[model samples]
Target: MLRRGNEGKKPLKEKIILHYDILFKSHGDDSFDTPTFWEEFFLLKAHPDYIEKKFESFVAKDLIQMKDRLNFLFEKCLEYIQCDQPVRVINALQTMSCLFRGIHSVEVGDHGFDKINLLVGFDMAETSMQVLLRCLTAGLTNDHYNTTIKAVILQLLLVIATGTDNISQNTFVEYLMTNEELYDTLLELLTDPVARSRLGNDTVLLLALMVNYRKYEGVNPFVMRLSVLDDELALSCLGSVISSAFASFNKQFVSKQEESKSSGLFSTITNMVGSMFIGDSDEQKQMIKSNEAILLALYEAIHLNRNFISVLTHSHTDATLVGTPPHTPGGTDDESVPSQPATPTPESFVDASTTRNVLSTFLQYTSVVMQDTKLKRNISSTKLCFIILTCITEDQFANSFIHDENMSFQVCIHKMPMRHRKVKAIVEKPGAPLACWLLDLTVEFIVSHMMKDLPFSQHMRCLGIIHRLMCHEKKCQIRLSYNWRELWTALINLIKFILSNESAIFGRWKKGIFALFTLVINIFNMFITFGDTFLPTPTSYDELYYEIIRLHQVFHSLENFVLRHNANPEYKDVSSRLASSMVNVLAIVRHFNPKIEQYMKDNNMASLTEEEVLEIVKSNYDDLTLKLQHSLDHFERYSERPKETHFFTELVRSISEQYRKTMVFDNIDLQDFMHF
Candidate 1:
């Protein structure tokens, strides 16, 4: 017998086998696992790290003389896994994970894998499967090191169920459906926390692989059932898997090739979102908010699925944010200052009634503008903004949505006081039924969120728009004698409420604002065209008379806010680069007349129709060439021509076009439009 040196009493897993093999030839009737010393020695083999490479020569000697010591080890695993000790049964899963690692890194080819696979399939009972599920589940919450092992086993099973290259895929797929116990075992693993966290997003990655392999089913009910799970972790896993299935699928996999599974992922996600709150209990809700692992998983799911993302992000009617902050705008009251409101602004020329009515009209018109889907908005931004804006203005506009009180279709008619002292009302009709209701709900949500605890940038962007509209000449109506200083003062004070206190918008919110602002700027151009015009081009301006008051109010508001921020040590330079440039445009807007009103009046041009007058104005209007150039020169001294860049960009783009123009008209779908 070859005597390998015994260092720290190595397990006779090899030695006992070697002794048995030698006896099988030279001697006879030898078995192992003696009560104390040998059992203790075998226990040491449980931890392979203790057996150093210094003993490698001994390991080779033992294997050469012994009969497959590793195969003998796995036989012990099968025997003890279902025995008296359930706690030690978990060790089998760890050993299995390690075994797979050994097979991948240690085994060379099909021969090694076949040996490994044969070991894995060693006739396990239903109890064994359940125990493995429980072990995987428990391991998820176990210490970090244990989680690494459990994850490997789960990945192996997932791949075994789906992958093309794996021999286990065909058998596992059939077993998943017909083999009820097997399917339940897989389900139990999914509900396990440690396994899920380990898998993270790879479950989706695997599903993508499944679809690509043409081994996928159409509208799987098991996936559907899992999606409806009340547990956030399970739901999140389901959602990620669903989104991945959708994304993983491409034009390559069609009905002709793989029996078109078109709505499987979409239906799964939609149903999940619709029922996210249904039957979800207190424990589960708390579990969702506090669990960082689960929250990240849920966010990933929400991020990937378009329909699910829409419901979560938009704050619409049916789906609302659960733990939203309270709404407080730091706003002054409307004339009647409650104990809470510090001091209200002093009145200018326009009364509160007229101002409110004007705002109401603006809201209604804005609702119409928002709900106009004829502009071909094929994506999320178009839908989200239009939906949100409509919902916000729903209370203000009667036509766009059915009022809760009457549930009747009614036009929101605002009385405009004509020069002759006669009042004429302007009415905008409602859009389609579904669109109007959805939009109205979204509007209400936005207004509610706007008033609530939100980031300051939200207030700054939204309120800035509102303040600009309020101070429009048609609404503000400040007389020529009225000091521009007081108008500036009124506008400035309001901005203080908006950017008052908060974290700045520097990331996604900033980018989203830029996108929204793009729409707003286009809308502003439309609004400007609809206003007083002496244009050669329809989009051109009346200039000197209309006050261009929206831009003026915004300018004043920004300047006041910036100066205030700079004054406060905490807030200095925090107004953002976006705020400063707004002031520059406001400063120079005074120079643009398009065609000087006095010069045109001296030439008896007041009688000319606006369209005819537009031609002369277009030829004469050198807003970019002369006035903006002059403003840019002055701007360089103070703010380094911040506004000039945007001003010139617009000025050059607009002025070069042909002067022949019509008013920026309200285009509506008469087929869908319901008038009151």
Candidate 2:
């Protein structure tokens, strides 16, 4: 026999080894009976040449023991995050490059997730992120790697951590801050739109991690306290912060979504950047020494910096800053669609408009709690404690992140009518008003995202939201002069549908019923409004018409939401009266035009043929649904089922019956009250 000198393998491409190693480690200690998506994912498709040498002998089924495989696969990532390895900076890029081309499903899969969290979690290893920082700075400057290569590498790291959350709070970011190279490398990615485009959920999570991670100057952990005057750096940093925030939504949170209970991260970025606009107000009538040109450049930079624009425009930002960022031109483009838009845009921008539209639509089902019933019952029955708690907690959480507490508190009050005037309440003082008001807003957001498909969908959540808000703050309603009873009643009404997954109170589709139903009802917790006024009995035909109205209301609501949240006061017109009017008109329309609906169905118009309708619905749904699509709801502690919402039930039942029976006046008789 020949000498056995050739059997041993030579030094392999670092990435190839990394790919195999990560896959091997991620495979875990489990077994697979059949072929797994693992090999077809990381190695075989990624480095087919290397597969023959390393994994060729391993059966595809053998790849199932994910922990072992993944441990080997992501060993590099684990090492890099902990700042371990021969050349962590180089290895980090190599690991990322390999991950970019390979399937990211490993990290997203059940077993893969556990491994990554364990590896990348706080202090998984001893190495520092400083190496990664150096690697990035040096990598970008090298002629060998272009922007695309950098993108691929960066995206790869992102792929590994897609839905795994709180990744920002880890120490990896802290280590990187001490290392200028990596931080600068990230800055480049944030500043360059072309490069940032490649960053998706993974990038978002990484940025979140970076923002929350401690920055090291000498010995202490650092914060991203940005200055308004530092436009060049601020612009890109702002973009990165926004990108990171929005990216948090980019993951496929099919099961339970991981939401930050504490608005800590969201508040951090918003308030820090918000300091720039500290004095640009009508009431205060103050402006920093910074001149006009600087403002103009800031506007252009934010606009050109797509990531920043999308982030700052998200619903999480303070409502005052929601509109166009101070000096931007022509306001937000996404805020222009009216309801039933027929055409919808892609979900590249999860801006403020998207969030507002979602919330506004959900509020339609709200009923007046009746000055009679608010807080009338016990702790559980009243659901007051829960509502108050959510608000107080949200305010506390958001405030903790605000560097200038007074400014944030001012904004919290500004959302109210003459909020600055300040009134006394349970929590005490002007700042307390914001906490109360914020609870209202938060509950409003929850109700806005209700759905009929999930049974007592919106109804359950609405009650839950309200209850949470009322938990710690009892006198919150004192802040609003309007009839809070009706509003609270409406919330209970929405919650009813969420609790019971009955037939869509609106209607069911004739074709692709399941899929369409999922898209319309299950996929989205959209609101439903019926009749111009009064109630309709539940009937099949009525259900269909009601569904149409629901679609319409949702559309208008979305359009308004976008405008309202975008800092455009125009969208905030959906007052209780306005909502009531729309409901009345919808009822009358259903009462009179039930026949047209049948005719449209005969002519195929019943299917909502207009692409714009789908667009608006999808866009609005995407905006809010993204939050739900993640399992954020799971984190919320539901206290108890809300009191019966006769108002919502009566109204929904009224539409169902009237439309089914081809009767109208009961739902909307225009003789006494003019038709809307």
lDDT of all the models against the reference? Answer: 0.32, 0.32
Candidate 2 ranges beyond 4 A from true positions: 1-133, 141-146, 156-178, 200-202, 210-483, 490-676
The digit string of per-residue lDDT tens for model 2 on 3-110 reads 668658776566544545544543343332123533222222234334334444443344444434433345444344333222333334444443322322133334
What lDDT, from 0 to 1, does candidate 2 have?
0.32
Angstrom error at residue 73, model 1: 3.0
lDDT of 1 by residue, 367-413 (tens): 32222222222111123233233233222232222213222222232
Report model 2's TM-score to 2 decimal places.
0.29
Candidate 1 RMSD to the real structure: 25.4
In model 2, state the lDDT of residue 65. 46
